[model samples]
Target: MSLPPTFDPVRALSLARETLSIEATAVNAMADRMDDSFARAVALVLGSSGRVVVMGMGKSGHVGRKIAATLASTGTPAMFVHPAEASHGDLGMITAADVVLGISNSGESEELTAILPLIKRMGVPLVALTGRVQSTLGRHAAVVLDASVEKEACPHNLAPTASTTAQLAMGDALAVALLDARGFKADDFARSHPGGALGRKLLTHVSDVMRSGDGVPRVRLDADLMTLMREISAKGLGMSAIVDGEGAVLGVFTDGDLRRLIEKSGSSVDLRALTAREVMHPNPRTVRADALAVEAADLMESNRVTSLLVVDDAGSLTGALNSNDLMRAKVI
Candidate 1:
């Protein structure tokens, strides 16, 4: 490849802006063109007993893959099958229980149109995403979604730029409508994306990332200040929970309290005279073990504390966790 003799930055920037504007206009026009056909397409997918088998060719195939992925992650079962491959043996993947979503900007792609008759004969509902509803692919469809674009973003008006954008926007609209109809919530989305950040936040619980048993730093109420500090340092949680004889949390002594006590008392105060009960902050923030880890992070941020006491429903100290623990679990 050779560089252009003279690179015109002005022309390049102008074309880039024009391309974005055209695609934006195409997608906006699709939103305005949404009609009963779009709703019927959503209904067809919802009514299907199996998955949504999305088929497209060329650039439309790329958009179909993305649409299928979005639909599958958002509570709708969907998969993308290449049009040309479907003509070979991939059509066996489709069944009567599934719905076919065919994409063709011209509604005349030989690969896609070749399988339209076979798909129809299978008694499967065909939802067409095409520019020409009167073409072969659209005429044989049970529901036709108009994805027509005024023009392509390409300067020569040959590439599949604006038309592909319209198809993508229409696919997203269908997925969102079906998601709402199925009552798909954030938790449902998280379940599908277990390795994602949202999944970590919604699925991780306090107990899953908390320090339990001897791992928790705790000192008796009557324990000396030195014992409390030792426990805090030993556990590396920056704080020590003061518990009663029944192992119930009474208060918490944090490193902040220690600094304040030393600053107020100066060098004249006897450090050995202090007890856990005297220096501990009463009613420290607590979280239940069953609560979400993200909830613990929010509680820490709102209270401006780095550590929290994980307790049972009966108010007994069951575990302990700090901001570091949540971060380690990737729940922050």
Candidate 2:
């Protein structure tokens, strides 16, 4: 691949800036031109009981796939079907209960237009995202969304640049409107994207990541400092809970407390003779096992602590967690 003989750095930069300006203008113009048609389109899909079937060709088809994904993730059920493939028996994917969203800058792609009559025969409502509202695709649609652009960002004005931008912006507008109407929330979006970070934060609970049973580091309130230190070392949590006979957390002691204790007492006091209750920090922050993992992170952060005692409704210690546990779960 060789640079064109006419390629100048200054010219390239200017052209890039002009391209962005043209696309931005196209989107802004579309926003200003929005009318009741946009709302009606939203209402049309909302009223439907079936999924939205999206279809397009070429670059428009690529944009259609993205729109479908965005809609699905945002609570609207949608999928994209290739227009050319629809001609070869893929039209069976459409159902009378579904709404078809057709995308084309010209509104006259042969592959797309060829299926308009079949879609009409099936009685599936059509929503057109096109530059020309009077073209064949628009004429067959029950609701028409004008995604028209004044000109292409391409210097030749033949490529699909600003036109495609307009279509994408219009698609996003429709998805957002539908999402709001449906009362879609972050949790709903996370459900569709369970592999993403938001899902982990919203869906993962403290019990899922906390150390349970013997994994929890704890010592009786009457235990000596040596026993407490041994428990903390074995669990490797940097801390041990001071629990009563019934397993209720009374207090906690960490390596930091040990260092501070040694610094304050020096060799003047016998540190080995101290009891867990006497050395532990009372009223340590605790989190409910049912709480979200992100909530635990927030509690730890606000309290300037790296660990938390997991308790049940009765305040009985059920488990424990540290910053390392959260990091391992990717919830931090």
- Each candidate's TM vs. the true structure? 0.97, 0.98
218, model 1: CA deviation in Å? 0.3
Candidate 2 matches the true fold with a TM-score of: 0.98
Candidate 1 CA-lDDT value: 0.94
Writing each residue's lDDT as its tens digit, candidate 2 over 184-294 gives: 999998788888999999888999999999999999989999999999999999999999999998999999999999999999999999999899998789999999999
Write candidate 1's Cα lDDT for 1-332 as tens digits. Answer: 97697888899999999999999999988888788888888888989899999999999999999999999999999999998998889999999999999999999999999998899899999999999999999999999999999999999999999999999998898999999999999999999988999999999999899999999999998899999999999999999999999989999999999999999999898988899989988888999999999999999999899999999977899999999999999998
Enumerate residue pairs that collide in model 2. none
When summed lDDT is taken over every stretch of 10 residues in candidate 2, the lowest stretch is 187-196
Off by over 4 Å in 2: 1-4
